[model samples]
Target: MAAAPGLAPDAPLHIVSNAGSGSKDAHEARQQIEAILTAAHRPHEFILIDNPGELARVAKQAAEAAVRSDGAVVVAGGDGTINAVVQAVLPTERPFGIIPQGTFNYSSRAHGIPLDTREAANALLTARPKPVQVGMVNDRAFLVNASLGLYPELLQDREAYKRQYGRRRTVAMWAGLKTLLREHRQLIVEVEHEQGSETLFTPSIFVGNNALQLEQVGLEEAEDVKRHRLAAVIVEPVSTTELVWLGIRGMLGRLGDDERIRDFPFRSMTVRLLSSGKKRTIKVAVDGEIFWCEQPLTFHVAEHPLSLLTPTTVK
Candidate 1:
């Protein structure tokens, strides 16, 4: 991949850290990051964000500052924070760096960024900027998967359940069960992609930009992330008992064997709600965060490539 032109070796760096990520205390993480940058003789500015709600604002400001100075922005947080930062920086020519501090760190992991903060920082110092494809739903950019129906509802319920009970597998499973029982509604949708159009009466639809993560769940087989296409999977509606069984199969990482799951790839896709009223809208989850988008929802590869600072060892 070709590198972006503006991010030179001596350009200044700006780092945005989310306070509530991972198991490490916010202060401790900041201290460690500062120490690593200092030891590397890299001059940088650090912005510590205490509230989740302020992340987008703070990141956008940092990205604007970085663009003005011909610098780069290093995001030190999980997927949600990274997603916000990516959106903020995508408009600029500035290169983006990542230090994974989230539970899954799917974006960083897919790009081969080291999970350890110190090591990730080292990779940042040594890595080169490479242009990578980004996926867009409506106008917002997402580096991971975007989905509607059961998955989004499950994500909403899981967060609420996690707050009340805890972040355990059992709690998550219970949350899934509760959500499915309460909010399991079928979607009657018309999907138009590069291949053709199809009418589907399914309970869920998932479109993936990070195909590796989809493969991890046995939903896809493609390993390439720079393909510049979206991988989509639709789950055929089934009885509640069968749905629970399917969920269990997903948990056991055997979803690929399930006959009801259909997978395909597309350069662009449009999903329209068949039962929609005059003003059509639906709640869709982009990289695990939920938002309402107007239908027919349009998805495609972003117009510009995202400049990413990734380890040279990562191919």
Candidate 2:
């Protein structure tokens, strides 16, 4: 594992955030965070990006300012915003102090940061950026896996359902069920790895650099990046019955015993679009944020420690 970056006792702190992204109630979240930080008596500055595509520019500028002033930055936004900042400041010594503001903050969840924005901000004072693992896909940094499957469909329908019936769990579940019935097509993925290769005919494949530490698995106290290796599981359900059965089993933690979830673990894997007679494209979701992309998404582990603040360590 690489040595964790050193933090100064008086390193200048900056908070980067978008005021409005998820859940309309978060309109005042930035202001609230600032207030909490001020109350904590921490020396800090807050920089807000008013519009889209400005996050990268603002982050670069802030990073430069930090360099000139000898400081660090704390980001308060959703997963996409965090991804943007991380991507913008790659290979630089600028460490990110993350503040979760997204619907499902996967990065924070992976790092064991507090879920509540207010609590997460306060935890910054005591927490140090520990040496943690990161995943890189074609040079794009992602805290979680780049996934294609029913996950993307469920996200689309979930949003539409939210429009009809405000953020209710039952409505989201119904929407997912309806989407599953409509889209029953299988996806064929040809996977290439360092040692060998294989083909899979399934609904989707989730190539994970980091196993999700929230909901399904608990966080580990000391995640030694050097000792651990990246794992990928390709879904291969031939029939609807098999899909449903395997999905339930996976969700119930029985996936270790299910054949479909068992695949070779590789240090790196590239998935190519292999559908014939059609323009092969799929909606990819990285850490719960969705985007459309063509074939051949690469997945591999990158060793880097993201500077973050947390109240206490959980294993």
Candidate 3:
């Protein structure tokens, strides 16, 4: 692990620590950060945002601070909290710095930030920030991919399932397989790709700006699987029996280059919850955080994206 990046001699920084949302050793990590800052002779302010609805407010304050001091806005939390700050943030004078302390911190991990708090903090302090694309669902910022149908359903029971199974959480995968077998629910997904408009009945759909390549896919490199286009994929099943087989296939990571599972690249995609009311309520999960919102959900790539400091050279 390295020390926190030295500020421009006597630079000011604003740190907003999300309360009750990080790993168990957050306090010790903060102490380490404070010690580093003190040793570097850098002046900083630490605000523990603990009140309800205070995250967004504090985020805005941090952004404003970044603008005023021309320094960095640093956040310590999990994926959801990170997503909240990313969404709330505006283009500022300084870049955003992150320390991953949440469950499934894939964004941080994907960017090559260390899972350990102190190591990641050190990397952020020293590394050069790189610009990366950010996705917007109806103008809501997201760091990773978004999903519909079975994903929302599966994630809905994630907490309950996690608690019940604990270390044996693979049970959720089995349960999802069972849901696929017993419940023959099909969603009417209308996708407007660069080619044209096509509607299909899918069990689930994923709108991805990037793809996590698995070994079953037979790829050594997990490069920019996503480009200016979004990947729309469906794991379609012919019947209830076939649905179970498909789930098993997906779980075993065996379904690769199959016709039933297709990926379409598009610059934009819109999803409408067909059965829902005027409110257009659909469960949308972005970067592992779930929320209920009505659709037609509009997703597009943001023009001016943030600079994510990562270990990789790829933008």
Candidate 4:
């Protein structure tokens, strides 16, 4: 824990909003948020993001403006959208807020923020900034989780599927099944963690920083998260049928007892690419966005906890 960032009673809000990131009607959500702020006589500005490429720049601008104006930077989008803003604001020490607009909003749900964007907007008015831990990978901040290997590929495929079949959870699930059944490459990596180091043949290595998410996925590692340690799940190589059955077990809250997967807890971990040999570049999915990062990648708790604006004291 750290000192809380003080908020002024009438501080202005610099909100970085992506108008089309989630399934909700952004226009109506924005209007309702504006109405709340207007009724409360709070001055605010929404920095609308026009495209995905503009997210980083928009977040930087909002964070800088909030710092200069003694206000706070608020993000109205999904986990990936908020991750960009967190990266920008963390270095500047600007107070940050979130109006949840995505499915399974891990960060917001973990902090006890309202799931409805409009309700979260109203809560933002009286919220106070609290220091909260965030997971960091190769200098990028992820509030919930960061992963590599087959999981990243699944996310990439899911995005492509979303563009083709529409944005729905069922569509994402179908995409995952398609990716799983298709021929996949194994990830050979040298993992250096607290316990020891080993070259594990696995399809995906998932590192979770949020207890709620890990628990929902039926992983006992969620308890590790509660103990202030990062939880990791490594999916060992298995037949396609077994893999599908494993996924079903996960959905049914039986993954914790499955022998096909190995779970561990660590304060920090380093991963080096072994399969690619000379090529160190790999696709990593942080939150829900995918990007290329040159290995070796270090996963650890950030040096400084983010100044998150929550409706109540964060657990």
Candidate with best TM-score: 4
What do the candidate models score in CA lDDT, each in turn? 0.82, 0.66, 0.65, 0.86
Residues 1-315, candidate 2, lDDT per residue (tens digit)? 675576665676777766435445566776677787688777788777877667778888777766676667777776767777776555566666788876657678777788787788777766675656666766667766567776777677877987888665467656666665554677777878987787877787765555563224222211322345565666666566676665455445566556565544556788887774476555787755677666567777775655544445643
Regions of candidate 2 where Cα sits further than 4 Å from its true position: 20-24, 51-53, 163-175, 213-227, 276-282, 293-295, 312-315
lDDT of 2: 0.66
- The pairs that clash in candidate 3 are 5-125, 78-102, 280-294, 280-295, 281-294
Q: Candidate 1's residue-wise lDDT over 84-138, tens digit each?
A: 8899999886899998877678889888899888889888887888787788999
Worst 10 residues of 1 by lDDT: 219-228
Query: Rank by TM-score, descending?
Result: 4, 1, 2, 3
**What are the RMSDs of all candidates, in order?**
2.4, 3.7, 4.8, 1.9
Estimate the TM-score of every prediction: 0.91, 0.81, 0.80, 0.94
Give the 10-residue window scoring lowest on summed lDDT in candidate 2.
217-226
Which window of 10 residues has the lowest lDDT sum in candidate 3? Answer: 213-222
Best by lDDT: 4
- Per-residue lDDT tens digits of candidate 3, residues 90-208? 35525666778766566776667787877766665565555666777776777767787777776666656766774233666655665666565788767665577667787787666
The order by descending lDDT is: 4, 1, 2, 3
Off by over 4 Å in 1: 1-3, 19-24, 165-174, 181-183, 221-226
User: What TM-score would you give candidate 1 relative to the actual structure?
Assistant: 0.91
Clashes of each: 0, 0, 5, 0
